[model samples]
Target: MEHMDSSMDIQHLLMMGMDLYRWTFHDNWSEVVEQYKNNAAIHTMPINNKEDTALHVAANNNNAVAVKQLVDEIKRTTSAVESLKKKNGKGDTALHCAASIGSLQMCMCIIEADPHQGHVLIEERNKDGETPLFLAAAKGHKKVFFYLKDCCVGESIGLCRRTSDGQTVLHCTLYRDHFELAFEIIHKYKEGIVGFVDEKGISPLHILADKPSAFESSSNFRWYNWLAYQCIYVKPLRITSHSKSQQTALRGSTADTENPASNYISEHENVVPKNYWTSYDIFMAFTRFIIWPVWEAFGLEVIKTSRKKKEKHVWCGQILDGLWKHKDVAYVGGRVKAYVMPKPGRETDGPKGDAKQSADGGSQKVTADQDKLQGDAKQSAGVGNQKVTAD
Candidate 1:
């Protein structure tokens, strides 16, 4: 319970076990026994200026070997779970330190050492309401983030969680230009997260829309931009293809590398929609999702008398309205549908080889049958047109 200053005495005490802390960072485990035997009390004693235990110091240093030994040595006397859970001055356990440092090995060492309570430890939040996975994301540590993600398999989907500031790991990725990681969050978390507006009232789409410059710097900008726009702008539509061949064509040419989607839009059969989506849907999405927030915050303003008048342009909505009113968008013939991209969310919803092959095959068969029914309806319409011409 005592506070240890950063002074030499504390440094010297930390030197004992914390030397093992440093040594483990270099991955040297030799003579660890003699070191622990010589000054067991001192090393186990409160060490850092913040009074971080030896384990905390080791984790802060990203020393997996030291963390493992300390956990092992301590497991004999006290519970490894409790020791790993101990917090320092900043309310961070060794796991928190490891996560912030983005060291997967160090984190795994601590977690594996205390398997009984590791899940609790991994999910534990610091003062910031950020779990270890969140810290890894904040640090741009994808490998560490991935390992921790696997641990949250069935139950804690909150692994893709937000911080106290209402920033998810997806936001953290974009802030650091980890483009792929941003998509990973969208694909992994799906609808449960995609609709969530953070404390700032900004959805993930808002994040991408704000950072257009990010597209310029991304190495896989084509893929990244396409994916971002899909999650941010298109996913909400829930659009579907009209025919089997259309779906197959889209599945093959999703990327520009093979065949651009624009080619299909201009040349191929119009991708028919499954449901009716009206102008209001577009208006609501633009106003509520995009335009209103900006309009409310920084849109056109005029000063009248003693007060300033803020006029809502509802600009995003206005743009959609203008486009529809202009007759530039043609609804003639079969309605064209955009090709669906296979992203993380799509992984479980993809091909015969993936996600429950038999079930997916059945769904495909159902789709084929629906396509046939539509084809028969079109033939009947053709016959009706011919009879009217004869009359």
Candidate 2:
């Protein structure tokens, strides 16, 4: 009787494990919690063949609510930190999944739940030696990258260390064409990473060199797109405005103590001229009101995309200029010739051909400037009219 009962218990536990796996996979958080309350082992069981826990599934699914509830349940029943630190088949923690998916809320929940080792968690590398910060940059999650960066304040060197295959976050960022984030990485961490070469003998400079299209000379914008690009204006992220206290103080100081209404009337008059609705002004206002809705519905996104593309080209130039200038001071000059100089048969003139098609003033200047920059860079790097073809 005892032997039979033991076999039955084992069968029942297997059944429970299978059910927990299903619930977690489908994001059935309510059922998962109930199963966990009954058997704490469900917290550690491999939900899928990847060996991911319930937390991993919740995080990968970007279900922050499920993550919070699961974290709380684990804290009451088991070790929350250990549970949160569980890795899947690829050795990714729940935080890794959250960061890769760019779920800021899920990352915050996982880190906050681990009161003891939040810093450790941020620095925890997966099987590929990629920290959450590295994954964030690789996936081009700018906000999440900065957020994880904030978590690692004094450990920028360690945080940006070469991951598996000897590739740093900068290499991946540049290779992925995330020039804006790559610019921030280079600008922020100026030391210890200027000369990093991946296992494929590719440095950040090589990645930048291969991307001719990122430069303005290679951009193939239509005439209308160029017009829209010029007219589109992106608002500055940090705007300076008077604080509430300062506004109040200014109002008090400028007001006529004898009569507040007199000061108000004077200020209002200054804002509105006597001919506020002149023929030209009225015509402009009416036209704007009539066209505003149509523009919003049809033209806003296209113009914004053009503006962003233009900004990216600008950033690409800035990156190349900065990195090239820093070459003499740093150790990035080892393989400059093989990478920066074009091979005899390669597609070096692709940008110039595109430039001929573009009639924009900027495109013409860009072709000339790109040639000058390339020639100057080769001279600076001591190639001296000798080209070495890369394999």
Number of residue pairs clashing in candidate 1, backbone atoms closer than 3 angstroms, sequence gap of 3 or more or interchain? 2
Give one digit per residue, the lDDT tens place, for model 2 in 184-302. 67765553454555545455766666676555555556676767765653321211221222222322142322222222222233445766535545765775587655776775766
* Candidate 2 residue 232 C-alpha distance from true site, Å: 4.3
Q: Please report, in order, the local distance difference test score of every candidate based on alpha carbons.
A: 0.48, 0.61
Which stretches of model 2 miss by more than 4 angstroms?
Answer: 1-9, 220-305, 321-325, 329-331, 335-391
Residue pairs whose backbone atoms clash in candidate 2: none
Model 2 score (lDDT): 0.61
Error of 2 at 56 (Å): 1.1
Candidate 1, residues 222-328, lDDT tens digits: the string is 34333332233221212122232332343222232112232222111245443334454577678676765674566322111101100111121221222223121
**Top TM-score: which candidate number?**
2
Looking at model 1, which ten-residue stretch has the lowest summed lDDT? 304-313
Off by over 4 Å in 1: 1-45, 216-391
